[model samples]
Target chain A: MKNRKIRGAYTQYKDNQVTPEDSYWNRRDFIKNLGLSGLAAGSMSSSALMATIDRPVNSGFNTAEPLSTENVVTHYNNFYEFSTSKRKPAEMAVNFKPGNDWKVEISGEIEKPGNYTLEDILSWTRVEERIYRLRCVEAWSMVVPWQGFQLSQLINLVKPTSKAKFVAFETLESRSVFPGQKRGVLGFHVLPWPYREGLRMDEAMNPLAFLATGVYGKPLPGQNGAPLRLVVPWKYGFKSIKSIVKIRFVEQQPYNTWRKSGPREYGFYANVNPKVDHPRWSQATERRITDDSFFGTKRIDTKMFNGYGEQVASLYSGMDLARDF
Target chain B: MSYLVYAAIFRLLGADPQEEMLHQLGLWTLILLLSGLSLTPLNRIFSIPKLIQYRRMLGLYAFFYLVLHILVFFWFYLDANLAELFDEVIKRPYVTLGMLATLLMLPLVLTSTRAMQRKLGKRWKKLHQLVYLIAILGCIHFIWQSKSDLNEPLIYFIWLVSLFSIRAYFARKKAQ
Candidate 1:
């Protein structure tokens, strides 16, 4: 596995050389091995159990890592088609579209703002394989080997102005492309045309948040934010906008999709802080996506900032997370 | 599940202890939602005059899955940090909707018994109306829960909309 070098390009040029089912089985094995080991010999209290379980799985390639194309495509999602519940995304997102002709638009505070196609973007940035521990705001998680590059490179190339205080993202809007966009089922109020999200100037520029074009060293499947998507590792999963088409650098805080819908529930800075409690549920713990069977059973503790305090903690220096939360 | 747990202990020595729990919870949620939806139709169609009997069990099961959902979230992922749970429910609308949908169902579940329903009277229907609200909220809850994709919630909403519309149509027809 180490000897092989996966392609570093976008556009689903062709079906993955390795089959999707193969990846799924591999991921299942990876999940089985990692999920049962520590939990088996534990007499720890609930709190202690959570701390031990919550740590992200940092294993090597052959040591049961669920970074295959199938696992990347099927698992790790917030898409709730099967159930409104957490597990729905993975179950329902399986039948999504996968193809070429996908493109991402770049605009806003840039001097040269235009529609830079997916192919065009891939031509510039070389895809680097980086396995990131994704922690959602809902307290669920997954360790994904994401294949993309620093978002700063794209933003820098655009030459954003000094007035740029944040980088706003927009996902593709096609009633045909996305079945949910056509049907206003969740709420008639939410716009189906363009789903948007924004990140702080520094957070957007952080090397951790990649403008992911691919996953598992291959092109991203349509189900998993195909073409191009944003991956903000530290914050909740929603912060990372998927299937993006527009990038706007703004002086003011852009209206995020969730925050705009319900300001009280969603905040502008959705950093994954374990200190705040969701009015209806607790964000204190999470379930790693890789744990297929026990994925629902094993709950792990959350860190202050998804365990990236050393890197992104200063961003929220004096801000009251609970109040903002 | 108990049998599976027992068998796994001896056979699949390294079986995930939490696997059955997760499956049971998931299946329970599915059954709860389905059964909860059936109450109105069952009462009207079948001679389940006291259809309310099943409401609590169904609602409680839904709540049960929700609890499992939250437990799995906190235990396996967040490590039981009250603050982080607070942050997520407060900071994320999808999580909020998910949370609200479950929480709203609580009072309905709590007050679902025959005695409580008798005590509450007309207020019972009013309170239980929360089920419709919860179903809607649950749909929204699931819809937003999806970070980008919206297919699952869309399907659920289609079914829910049809169900509600049918109920509305029947009610209007009955009034006439």
Candidate 2:
């Protein structure tokens, strides 16, 4: 509770400064729009946790114009320790330490593979704001204005080899930083630090896959994979691994966290395809987070690669998605 | 507790509270199923007699949630759009798996009563074994639902596998 103000400090990120008061009203409007009065109820009932849960769902976009250069660099997540619920990460990450001593290792099929500090990566590229629609595999979607650039441009500096068929990413695997790693929720062996994910060579090189440094148009927040993260727009949300510390361009496929746990369920290219339902639920429809409740809003049909067909559908054109999926 | 939680959710987020209520029911149902499945393992580890008593409630809750989950999907999500629902069930693997899991849970719930248990006698045990099958089906339902977001459901799968593995190893040991 002492550090609650830490979240309120609305320093400028790309000139998009949302005052604490404005954010508070925004949250109120969001809840009212969602038909949720839980914040007021929680306030009356003396439940701070529920009040927190009722926080304005960060669509991550600065709706007002001039494309505020003061974009908040970090997008706080709701990943909770109690469960791997979509919103849990953001809620539970409030107490996390924002360490400055972060160092990332870049290796594998690259010409120059070595350790690089967070500052090194940021110095390479100027952050740019782009509004993106994040469609979670759970059939929920949110539009966010993110700050970063094509990771390939940076990776190109390393000069990946011709044999570098796949580019795998990894995140720091620390219980102190990520409490979820400590629990035996899944049978993942902590052989190395930073949980891993990979993309096909071209996919990794694609302009759409951003090497994000900040979100909401500013420097990345500690809770939202501050310092750096990956944002693969066409894939499922998880593929955009956060809090990254390692980048390996390999000829062979990388041992991805989710895929290693269940290969039958999670494919390497976790693209958002309504046609390819996740054996347990249909992905044909997704709940848009911004829809006003007064209209009795319903799920809209999901498109292939989440409407990035023009840019990404060709990636899997020759391959049998059903079989590969 | 989850039932009360669902009621409270309905009271709070009034945007088709049934969907949210049903979502909670489905989640808790899976949790209880995993808990129920863990009974044998817990019994094996601690030799506790009381754990088995809760299995019935847990299994019934799983069934309860499954029914509610399906009803909400059909009524609210589907919205009496029978053709669309039918098309989805036929075309979508996830929807099909969900339906399959729900349909399989129906028989188990119907025969869950003390009268049915007494009437079936030896056959009741055979009938109840269907829970293991239901659990597997439920897991498939979740796995498919996850797409590739396997973090949560993988935990359930791991727990379910461990529980069933313990039961299997013990059964083999007992036979030997």
Candidate 3:
């Protein structure tokens, strides 16, 4: 999979690829549309807000394995901002508008530190579809076709100083939009709001490091981190923070949400190593999220660095992964 | 129940059906188990001797849920991979506790009938007290398996501890 040249530039992702099982997702979207209309009546115009977050699928990366349906990918989420329950976020984040001016503040040891709109930041580089296997720390996995530009593009544009040791990513903290931040995760209010995640400067500069603008081609819906989010293929899902509003190039090891909330369980370098089992569950295997006819998710053996070790292993050559994990 | 099966059939079980099923089964089992365990304590405290009559039914229902839980795990979770099931039972300490607790429940379930209860007499009551051990095992298994947010598990743990403490209080009163 080394630098395979793109064959096609624009293959319109025909929405016709969906299965009959899409009836349920349609029902959900129908309900969401009702809510969207109510919001439109109250605030913004209907055209401005999305009824169904559908975008043309850009053909970039190729995979023999089937991609998880766009509906399931968007409907089933882990954004703790709206709710901890995977299915609830879709319904709860209906009113969550990332707004016309979503600014991502580039701070710390960067040369050109300023608050730039998401569109301004994206102008630095081009977006491409990266079909990557996202393995959650919960031992469930999904192969997502992400629309993102490499983080290196932004890093190059901003130019981090030698003092920059780490790159921290922070999510939006408006409790009004994110109901879970206002309330708690299943009434268990533990994590500090504006979820924080970071990477070593070298890790941030990795070819695989991605700042995803969309999933399944459409601009990201509120449930799946609208506007922007990080997508690090090698690390556990939490390391790839959602709905990022701040990007700081820090000198010290930055404050990460999980590492702060659960120091023993969640480490800084959350590289997907199956050998290093999570304290809660064995990472030896993961349930690949396939919308099988019977909903029978296939359990497959997890690989080192979630099958991206070839590209990312050099980043942690001598360091003990087991200890770090 | 039938609701879960219907949900699965209609493809309304969300993203991971098997995981959701397993979770539901486990939750019902824990609920039933705790409810059954509470009956005797409730009887003593409230002087409602009739409450003792329902304890056997509650225990049986809890066991049934546990059976379904195991079925879901092997059939869907491991996809009838007996080797992997054994490996999980052997490898994970939490799984080991759960399996052991399940194994121990068998004898109690076997001797639950009226004829067997009559034949065993005093020994039946003694053997049934093993529910205390099973309850403790179940609580530990639940607590151990919890990832980081121990909110739910800790609640169950506290409930179990409180019940046991109440039982101990009754025991001391009997001694006095």
What TM-score does each of the candidates earn?
0.60, 0.63, 0.83
Predicted candidate 3 versus true structure: per-residue lDDT over B94-135, tens digit per residue: 889989999999999999998999999999999998988888
Ranking the candidates on TM-score from highest down gives 3, 2, 1
lDDT per residue for candidate 2 within A1-325, as digits (tens), equals: 2311222222324354323324534654664554454545444432233245432113221222111112111221433222344435545666654443458899998898889865555556555655566777667665566767778778888899898999888877667767766644355432233467888988887767787766654456666676677888788886888877888888887777667766766688889888887655577887555422322335678878877777777778899887776
Stretches of candidate 1 exceeding 4 Å from the true structure: A1-73, A80-100, A184-193, A295-297, B1-176
Preferred candidate (TM-score higher): 2 or 3: 3
lDDT of 1: 0.64
- TM-score of chain B in each prediction: 0.77, 0.85, 0.95
Q: What fraction of correct interface contacts does each candidate retain?
A: 0.17, 0.12, 0.31
Off by over 4 Å in 2: A1-83, A161-163, A183-194, A217-223, A291-297, A314-319, A323-325, B1-20, B27-67, B75-80, B84-176
| CA lDDT, every model vs. true structure | 0.64, 0.65, 0.79
Q: For candidate 1, write residues B1-176 as lDDT tens digits.
A: 35545644553311233433544554456457756886777677676878857766777778877788678655544557788778777777767776787788779877877899899999898888878877777777666554444554577778778778767877988999
TM-score of chain A by itself in each prediction: 0.74, 0.72, 0.80
lDDT (Cα, 0-100) at A271 in candidate 3: 91
Query: DockQ of all candidates, in order?
Result: 0.14, 0.18, 0.31
Better of 2 and 3 by lDDT: 3
Task: State which candidate has the highest DockQ.
Answer: 3
